[model samples]
Target: MVLQGALGVSLTFNCGDTDVAQEAVERSFAIASERGDPLDRLRLLGPMQMLYFRTGRFGTALHYARELAAVAEELGDADAATLARTFKGVSFHLRGDLRSAREELEGALSGRPPKEVASYLGFEHFLAAIFLARTFWLMGDTDLALEQTADVVSSSEESGHPLSHVITLMWAVTVFLWQGDIEAAENHIDRLETRAAAHGLQAYLAVADGFRGEVAVRRGDAAGGAQRIRAALKELHAARYELLTTPLNVTLAEALCAIGHHAEALEEVRAAINLVETNGDLVYMPDLLRTRGRIEAAMGPRKRDTAEATIHEAVTLSRRQ
Candidate 1:
């Protein structure tokens, strides 16, 4: 019963029904707690952390990470402990503590918990690898980041799990995009779209659409790309999936700026900044600020001071990280 409830939460979350997902998680946790089974509680903790993380509630996610660790230790579950560490690493990354994030993620990945552990933890190691790759990129190890990303994507594809394939492919798309490999990005997006569709994973589909739109813009279809991105953003907002909002908004702003739509670009940038500020999503703050600076500069001399200030803030944050 508790396991079914946990699965229910995961399914609803993938379908973008956040409220139902949270309710299901709460019910599952309640059941697990009542049963007084440490393993059951540990299992429920993973989804609870994920639910909060997906909603940009990093602190709450971290709280669950702590609980997960405690329960995993009580049960002597090394696999669960590894998964809990991964969650903590990701939460740390989101909170802008890059060094600690690197340490935790490295520890999790180094141990290479068995495949059964990955299955039991719902393949969270894939997510950990993705976050680790991102951290590597942010820390100026782009080559290693790309290598790690490729490894994760390849492994995920070989795993033959639609959920894992879609999630890993989505991050792989981001890596390709950052590398300026538009063709590679599009290819991964295609795979992600197919897998997400097969699984009825609406949230991943929306994310793919957003990435596809970004690729289109980069490929020189600025107007068309901007329209597609706008549509995807609408879908994401409707679904209350704010996980990718900052990056998508940045992409949209870049597309608009490319098309000489500085005013609209500025608006998008501001919206992204507001989102991160309100959600406490510092993971993308530096990028958001950088985009804001670019838009402000494109708005002309009237906003030059604002542009400098915005860019300076980004630089300061980057250095601190």
Candidate 2:
């Protein structure tokens, strides 16, 4: 019964029914706890953490990750413990604490678990590698970041985990986008779209579309890009996938600014900035701040001081990270 409930949680999450998955995970956790089965409890924590992470509830996800780490330690499960620590690092990444995130993720990657242990843990190592790549990129190590991300993408494809492969590709697209490599980003986005469509992964499909929209905007197709992004945002919001909202909104703001819609762009940027401040999601803060500055600058000389201050803040924060 517990196994069935846990499986249901994964199924519902893949189908983008996050609310149902959360309920199923809670039931599975309760059953596992009642049976005094530590393994089952740990098994249930994976989906619970994923559910919260996708919904942008970083604190709750971090809580589950810490609990998973403690339980894995009690069970003497090194691989599981490593996986839990990686997730904790990812939660820190989402919260914009790159220093702490890098520490934890690097600590986990410093050791290699056996093949069987990694398989038993369900490709968590790959997820950690992807996050680590992003962290490196954000820390201004583009070459190293690309190398690490490429390795993960290759390994994921060879591991026969299609879902993990697709996700890794999505992260790769993000890295390329950040590097201003539009052609490379497009290639990865195309691959991700194909794989996500094949697997019926709605959230990934939306993500792929969002990337495409950003690329289009970068290429000077503001109206077309904004339309695509708006459609993707609607789908993402319906699925309650708030994790990507910050980046997506920042992209939209850039598109609006391109088309001389400073007022709308300012509103969008400000809203995203507010959400980041409220949620402590510092990962995307620098980008949001930069966007806010751009919007303010477009508003004319009267706002120049505000623009300078905002941009300076972004630079300072980015350097600190």
Tens digits of per-residue lDDT, candidate 2, 5-113, equal 6665566546646666777778888888999989888887887888787777777888988998899899998877887888889988988889999998888787764
Q: What would you estimate as the lDDT of candidate 1?
A: 0.83
lDDT, each prediction: 0.83, 0.84
Best by lDDT: 2
- TM-score between candidate 1 and the true structure: 0.93
**Clash total of candidate 2:** 0
Q: 60-126 in candidate 1: lDDT tens per residue?
A: 7888888888887888888878988888898888878899999999988885444746455456878
Scored by TM-score, the top model is 2
TM-score of each: 0.93, 0.95
